[model samples]
Target: MNQVTNHTECSSLNNAKVAIIGAGVAGSTIALRFAELGINTTLIEKGPSLVNGPPICHLHAGGNLYREISDQQCLTLLQQSIDTVKVYPQCVNVRPTVVALPLTDKGEPQDLLPRLEMLRDKYKALVQQNPSNEVLGDPQHYFRLFERADLERIAQRELPKKALCDEDWLVAFAKQVNFDKLKFPLVLVQEYGLSAFRFAAIVSLAIERLPACTLQTNSRVIDISAKENGAGWQVTTAVNNDDRVNTAHYDYVINACGFKSGELDDMLKAKRQRMVEFKAAYVAHWPQCQGLWPEVVFYGDRGTPQGMAQLTPYPDGYFQLHGMTQAITLFEDGLVASCEQSAQPKLPARFIKKIDHHWPEQLVNDRTIGNIAHIAQFIPDFTQAITAAKPLFGAQQIPGDDPDLRAADVSFHESGYARAEIVKASSALAAADAILEDLLESGLVTSALSKRYLNEHYFPVSLQCQADEVTARAEQLAQERNYPIALANIF
Candidate 1:
């Protein structure tokens, strides 16, 4: 345990102590952010080291667009992602991403025009709102439209010889790449292909170096309970490989344990139901690409079982080819007992039974083969691409690794624990913001000073603007409707 720094005992903080369970990217980011605010923070991880856990390499900046999110929210998230790179440049690899639209029988790219135009309009609107926003330089420059001939030229120069010249291969590949489907192919610059392991390592290092923060590896939080007097929390942790149980008290607790957050939430009497789902994908690491292939995402057709296939290049001369299939839902009833039992000092029989019921150990090989076949459409070499073919969950212990886990679980319950989903590393920023806002309103810290700190250090320019706009819009809407405003309703 590291000695607490005197600076952490600031009057505004009222000698606040925060314990963040799980040292994944989300927890680590929050730990570092809180430490920077001169708060005494502790980051606990069940694993021996941060990088020893699950693999999460893909990172989306502005390139990977989602229809579900509002344009303003998307831009805000993108800016936060970019800001992450700015803060830790050495931990990421910035690269241009190419999203290939399907081609029609007439050899035209399908849906390219509408998609590109939509993006252009969206970018234009963002720039119109903030003329001086230079985070993403000129939107036109970054979002380039490439013609069929240009794409052919690029393929000829970059694709493998067999893929470039073979008529049969070309015909099969053409079905996947429709030049006539769209006016032109779209290219997005400033998107990053991150090394997840490296990013986690850097964050872990930063947390350890903070004088007011402590990094406790191999410490698994078994239970968290609110103090009887409601002043703080009592967190009980079971140290791995040691028959010992240690308990600590804190003013705040954040459950960034990724999948197992729901289990931790239960300990605090937070009864939110978290639905679990599993998607299997295999990653093939090729020694080298035939040509200068940047990160490529092949959009699946309507009938395709797999949703999409993404090829991400690493600086280490290897590409991670991923094929995402439709998710398999894990029934909520199946997980309740297991999740609850896992939080106890001793593991329950029902918990082990439940884990075996849902574990995908039998389908590992088949899932890997299926993923390889799906991705092989674009990269023919992917059919024979060298890969471990291990179940992704096999990379780390399953429900046993952390019992209360779920896929991309981010839920804020009445309990003090803020569960941050770790699917995208950038999710940490959102989680930290939520936690900070709660603290501000609780008067643990002065709102004005905290807001200044957030804006100056953590919040991106786009996010700041978006927050203000959302607030104003919500207020206006509330006045118009003669009702009180809620952030959720506004969004």
Candidate 2:
């Protein structure tokens, strides 16, 4: 096929051979969609596409999990977000029971009933019904929306409760206002294993639909250039140990490489983007000495300098304590786990330090064999919950590689960063406040996000460890180990 410039020719892209980069959810799904329309599509992934293959560093699945956007125009974005989050379900631990804490005499902890009044008073809701609407509170509020009450009730009876302080022991029993696990769902668990499992499942949902997407592991996209005709783009990737260079051309390219997307923009001389990095870590724990309870328990910190840790269910038969502020061991199998010490879309160094210090000694390498086993052994119920959600099948194979290798390579260079996001008027992210607006219109999103249970109650507690302390301790550790450290926050 020759390079064509006619708008009429390209607009009818059906049956046109399409090339996509990064088989991660976005690229793979796009290829599948094109193939469904009878368009021949080739998906190019720089990593092994198989589920158990080499691990790839990807985006954190937060917005993907709890987003309330449901519009068709917003579906693509929502699907992509959910796909990313689902990849690490076990790690995104969801608490079945959210027990509110009340201060008692002698600094004891009291379990306050989970009430609708608490939701109403703590969370501001501009209830949307038909034509009526209002903005009652902020959107950062955190509330426990239960999806499976009966299951929770059963689990509550079986699980053991963890107290924040040694002085408290009287655990109260009450139902919290939450969505049915069969209906409105809360997926992010703040724990480790289940969160990871869930993330994987969501990614699988999108990948399974693509029958013609090819994933090439250990392939790094080194350069991307546009042709002189402006009809297409060329991407040069370095494959394997041979340093072999393979160039593939595409009529269009979607930049979904997360933090590294800036490099592609530079190579293509296209629009530039900015990304921050953060230092994120997770600590999974199970008691070394198994406790008597068969159910999972959750605890909240009444007085804390930073975010409080949550003790929740994990797979295999143990509990996991993890959060943004503080992480602790709850059961015999508990292990301190760090997902990664650095992340792109970086957080401030001081902020990272604050968060890291919250973990005392349970900081284990997240990918280590021992830590993985401990989580699997202790969190049995969590394991069952995650396994049930993951589909047994895998994605269909990518199409053949025979026809397009002879195409000429295109050359290009970086111009400058895009001052404004240049998107089609119909593009899903065209609006400046696309995320907020979509939720507002959907009725699912409300000022309730800024409520005490959601924001003040949940958000601050999550950030208890603060980024500042984590970095400070990390620096000290590096100094003691005689290892020079970079003081930058990696996202």
Candidate 3:
């Protein structure tokens, strides 16, 4: 077992109690930040464990996947992703992502150059501010471009025994992709992967170690009513398989309930606009490959027949695949929104079942096979892949009606109440920081800035050195959660 030392205990400064209802990415990050400051925090989750809401494998270092969004959002994502990498270094799969545009794509390679250059400059500045921020490698080599001819020649080279460089990582992909079907040039960016299981273990460990933070798993918040005389908020919770319900009081309450956040909003008699989207990624095994492959993105129009396709590689020949098409990763009626009836979005029954991780066996196999066939279009050899595990699927909450909203932070619903709406896992830290600022401003948490040093020095580097125990716990979580053990591994 990993031992997280008792951090600061600032309860004496101001015995402020905080209740965060949800242990997903946002809620977990918030709880840790509060615990680090020695604030009394209760992190409640309805699930069997933490961070099981969605499958997050890709770290959007620069919002590269969403070309339609603004450059500001891209910059914000880059900054937030860097912070996340520093916090949970073990969860990051340290490999570059190969981004290719198919011949049918309307976008040209030059369309990416400006943003790439801007991101590179920003990365350089960040690293200059702190040398330790170079988690994605040197800023000068932030991204590499390869022409069709270059890939054609590299494809003829022998497979590498072990990938040592970015070029080495690209060998397997270069050998497989059909250049005839792609545009002239492709680019590789310094993006990484986030193993959801590993992240869960890290956050769970961090929470359990802090004396100020209480992790309540299998506990659901059934009601949230304001306390009499407006002294504080009253939280009613129901534990798993327990006949009795428990009530608690807190100075502040946070609604971080992944897709069910609006339920809390409704309970507080506040209506807000939000949308829920159901998506999935299939797990497949292709043992025929001899070399390691980095994450790959094939861009296309989403929700169409030839939508954006993603291939995420893991150890031992396992790969997680996603296709933005309806028949593959997306489904009809998978997205719904709130009306005047209630604040929660009403997803169809099929999506809700999948969100509960109860997909029919035949449907899982069909989608896995479809994902394999789709990848085979680019890499003809991928047809030999077989389903390895159940699809990682869940519904995500988008703050507003626009599902394209990728950047989000803490929203003050009312006094003594905050709501976090993060569209991507990378935004977790930013959202947490916002709540921390709120705490400081409201005089709820009074830690000397120098005493706390809420910068990069918050988490001790010594704790991160205990990777063996973290990995062990992560693997156990994967098995107990009915996921392939390989999914817990850092690819």
The best candidate in terms of lDDT: 3
Residue 479 displacement (Å), model 3: 0.8
Which candidate comes out best when scored by TM-score? 3
Ranking by TM-score: 3, 1, 2
| Superposed model 2: Cα runs more than 4 Å off | 1-13, 25-39, 50-195, 198-210, 271-273, 287-305, 308-312, 318-321, 325-491
Off by over 4 Å in 3: 1-13, 449-457
Candidate 1 lDDT over 164-231, as tens digits, reads 22221233233334455443544444355655544554565455556767888889888788899887
User: Pairs clashing in candidate 3?
Assistant: none
**Residue 148, candidate 3: C-alpha displacement in angstroms:** 1.5
Per-residue error (Å), model 2, residue 36:
5.1
* Tens digit of per-residue lDDT, candidate 2, span 1-491: 12122212222323333455554433433343333322345656565442221112222112111112222313333222232222222223322233321121121121221222233332233233211211211223322333344335533542245633211111222222222211222221111112222222333333344343344556778887777776566777888566689888765455444333444555654432233222232323333423222122222232232222233343333333332221212222111111122212233444334333332222344322222332333233222221111111111111112211111111122221111111111111121122223323433223433121121111111122233443454344334433222211111
Using lDDT as the measure, name the better of candidate 1 and candidate 2: 1
1 or 2, greater by TM-score: 1
lDDT of 3 at 60: 92
Native-to-model Cα distance after best TM-score fit, residue 349 in candidate 2, in Å = 13
Candidate 1 global TM-score: 0.70
